[model samples]
Target: MYGFIWRHLPGNPWVKALISVVLVLAAVYVLFQYVFPWAEPLLPFNDVTVNDQ
Candidate 1:
């Protein structure tokens, strides 16, 4: 798991940071890209509503 990787790659601080950042970004990308798209139709937005007069 993460502990094993952390122990084995203890000497590479840069690699650890890069991997952590990539993993965090990937999770965010997946949430916004896939999960948000699925709910897009359920939400609503109006650039010009009745009050726009």
Candidate 2:
């Protein structure tokens, strides 16, 4: 899959590296800004407790 993406990126090594970095940052930004927030309420992270019951 990575090889496929690398082949499709239209540039030499330096340009390809730059594009890959930008794409990764964009993905991270979108996930943190939208996806995680939307999913947070549906997850059980806040329900965790350390009780000796």
Candidate 3:
């Protein structure tokens, strides 16, 4: 998958690297701004409990 993206990106290696970094940052921003917030309530990570016995 990464190979596919790397192949499709235009320009020399340095340009490709810069675009890759931008794409990654954009993806991370989207996830934190939208995806994670939407999914957080459905996930079980916060439903913590302890057995006192």
Which one wins on TM-score?
Answer: 2
State which candidate, 1 or 3, has the greater lDDT: 3
lDDT of 2 by residue, 1-53 (tens): 99999999988999999999999999999999999999999999999879897
Model 1, span 1-53: residue lDDT tens: 97886667644889887887887899999999999899887778544457655
Task: State the local distance difference test value for candidate 1.
Answer: 0.80
Model 1 residue pairs with clashes: none
Per-candidate TM equals: 0.51, 0.89, 0.86
Candidate 1 lDDT trough over 10 residues, lowest sum: 44-53
Model 3: CA > 4 A from native: none
In candidate 2, what residue range of length 10 has the lowest lDDT sum? 44-53
Q: Which lDDT values do the candidates have, in the order given?
A: 0.80, 0.96, 0.98
**Where in model 1 is the C-alpha error above 4 Å?**
1-11, 46-53
How much lDDT does candidate 2 score?
0.96
* Candidate 2 lDDT score at position 2: 91
Q: Could you tell me the lDDT of residue 16 within candidate 3? A: 100
Model 2 steric clash total = 0
